[model samples]
Target: MRTALSMTLSSFGANRVDFASRIHEALSRVQRGDIDVVLSDLSLSHPFDGLRLLEELKTRNLLKQSAVFMIVTAEANAQTVLSAAELAPDDYLLKPFSGETLRQRLVKAVAKKQAFKVVDQAILQHDYLRALAECNARIEERDPYVIDFMRLKARLSLLTGAFLEARQTYEQVLRIRPAPWARMGLGKSLFRLKDYPNARRVFESVLAENPYAMEAYDGLAGCLEAQEDLLSAQEVLSRAAARSPAIIQRQRQLGELAQRNADWPVAVDAFRNTIEYARYSFQHDAGDYAQLSQSLLASGETQSAEQTLAQVRRAFHTPQSDLLAHVMEYGIASARGDAVRAGKSLQAAREQFAELKDNLPGTYSVALAEACYRAGDEQAGKEVVSSLLRNQHDDVAVLRKVEQMFVAVGRESEGKALIEDHANDVVELNNAAVRMAQAGDLEGAVHHFLSALAERPGSMPVALNAISAVLAYVGQHGWHDAYMQLAQDLLARVGAQDPTNGKYQKMMQAYRMVRQQFGIKGA
Candidate 1:
């Protein structure tokens, strides 16, 4: 293969090397931007291939505008073409081609890369409009990059939230050629438009033609899940996992789906594989370890569950993981019919939980609630569940999970009634506070909100209201040190509990306004 490539490059008066064989050496040079025009086979000897190398290079910000990648392969099967298309190769050169053929292909590939350099530069600079315009100009000029740039314009449309335009471009591309990339883009655009049925069929067709297209599987899974087809969605992810087991997220999803199906054995296996494969990647999560322990206990392997919990404790030594290990212990003991140990674990965890000056994250709170319920400590469990409900009342997924946990512990009736009563208690407190503020009694409003916070310490809505009520009271009545401190602490909980919320950024600005008026430190 190298000899063939050498003969081709020599006749074209171009330098070449076998990047497939000397992958590490080539990648090292490529990383330093010392290599260009990578002519490579479909696959390399090692796990990382030419396609993967290009992916890694892009990840490292090394794939510059000058890079020209042309797939030189003897085999251009559906799988190969689909994989190559994903990387957006400049061109493909099949075997049995003469030196002149190789020269022509390389020239065309380089020219395409160079012509699209303006668009690439614009994209890198985050100028989607300019990139789209350049693509449009090329298409109008009938350039060789007509199809590629058309797809680029579609992708930019998708990125810029022009889903209808992207759908139109993808449809046009499909008419030109029955291509997987166009079909996948069509599925995505349709998914964005909330046309789940059409998107599902489009993705299914793509997968039918190329089963190795992971993106198609993901899109199809999304479509199924959007339509509430959990069983079929799980089947799709299961198929994807069979094809590629090393994806931690897919394994985790499969584990979650198996759990939803009450398939404990499959859940256990999926989570176990998640743990094993996660060791080789940077995407490892303590949740997978905790979940594996839960699955093991569910499968009646108490000893193995304990050992896995211990392993995670050693693996992650953070305060969060420390809390997680105790949560796992409670679940394990409860499952093994050791209520005494389970209760002891929850008691210890509660003490540690309360020792923190912040509210629990939703994920941590859910784990604790499950453990507390299993240990027959419904009081602590109720408090944790209340925290979650108060923090995210609008989240259907959270509501469903809360019900599932209660059902699992045989407390469905009690859980439903408790959530409703506690929810009403907080809502009444918040509503009264809002009423007081409306009537111009900021003092009374602040008091009511504080009372609500006392009941549901994780309530962001109440916390934000209390902060506002206090700010208004102070604006009229002058600053009280304790009131200011309360406002700051409430803001802190907003960060500790759910910093990912879009509200966090906006609320931070409000917090800063108060801080500046009082000449205090940052929020």
Candidate 2:
């Protein structure tokens, strides 16, 4: 205990307590966050005893909060240990423990806490970069607590949209400790990366460890959903929701899944529960309201759905915020068999979107398409779908809405052709370059990408890919200045287009890494 305290004193900068028999005075210092661990006698004569001290720390949510509450009592009974465990002190120390044992425990505790602290603070504040940096530092420490660090860091990485990094972190953590949380993280990361087979393996492994790991169940469902295995996804989420009845998010997700599957009753129940639980979070979107309205409409609850739409409008006033509400209002009007009101509502929604056409291509297309569909102008609906099909070649969300419109207008074949063509074009371009590169034809790959970019000048992915290939070629040919200048110009354009595009941001990072490695300078 002395060795641990001494190490804590040196490493974490905790103040030293006088070696006195009065444990309360020492614990008083511990409460001030000056100490990160408390090695105290179970019995104390102070107004607040050791158990009281533990409870106080837990309530304050301080650094010393449950920091290591060691009983240090010779009378270690099952009842006392059970009570201690219930209070959730990290580790319990028995009486007559050696200094080395104490040292190991404290070291492990400190390392785990230090590794987790950065992630905890980052999560508390939603600062992902600091969390990732801290995780990397902890990974370098090579301590036994590295798995915990990796698990936490993987979650942060996923939040920051660093799915590949999160996947690597989860893989490393699972190598050390095949815990349910780590496996869940791995599954989620792989799911994000669209690796369904591997993701399913990770999720199944999590269920193998803990069948009640509801999060893994949700992840497995998500993987199935991504693969368009909707039936399996529904079964997975339904089982999870049934097993763990308290997680509102899971229920909400299940509702969304059920809604997508057109299981209206289940969707309505899930969404209702979701709204009940998500009333306080900033993450609460009008999506639940919109989903509920749709589900209610599907269930023939016309009056309730209309009321929900009205409430959504009162809650969120912006056209963008209330787009779904307006759409739902149109749905309600349709349900009431009021063709005149339905046409008016759809027209108003279309106008609302048109005014912001430059900023909302998808919204404009969707609103106009819906307006035309209900107005019985099949030609106008076709035009709207065509416009969206042209402008939203790579956006899955927009494309899906377009597909929905296609189904509504009964132009299923045209819709299939349009979506498949755009997707295939992109896949072909990406695949050709990748194949050439793999076949040791780097120059040929660059040429093909450049020609493709010239043909489709505004294609961000293609343009960026061309630049990347050229940069690779230029680096090999010792044309550092030319490539660096081109990269700078391309990066500036990417920033102008959208500072949040992952491919562009990654290309920029690669440029920086290369420059740093080679000490390359711009001309």
Top TM-score: which candidate number? Answer: 1
TM-score of each: 0.62, 0.59
How does each model score on lDDT? Answer: 0.73, 0.65
Candidate 1: count of backbone clashes, pairs at least 3 residues apart or interchain: 0
Model 1 Cα displacement at 239 (Å)?
2.8
Candidate 1 lDDT score at position 181: 82
lDDT by residue (1-523, candidate 2, tens digit) is: 5566566455645555444343344545554545556765553222223444554444333333214555555544523332312243455567777666767777776655653554555433333465567767878987567665666567556755789998888778668765555666777888889899999987787677566555678778888887889888988988876654545567777886786688989999888777755554333557678778878988999988978887777776666655566667777888898988887777776666555433444644575566577667776666656545544566676777677667656777877886888778778888999999888787898889878766554456776887788677766755566656766776676556644455665676667667766776542
* Candidate 1: residue 9 Cα off by (Å): 12
TM-score of 2: 0.59
lDDT of 2: 0.65
- The true-versus-predicted C-alpha distance at residue 207 of model 2, in Å, is 3.3
Model 2, C-alpha of 467: deviation from truth (Å)? 8.7
Q: For residues 33-81, what per-residue lDDT tens digits would candidate 1 score against the true structure?
A: 5455876665422233445455555534455555687766666462454
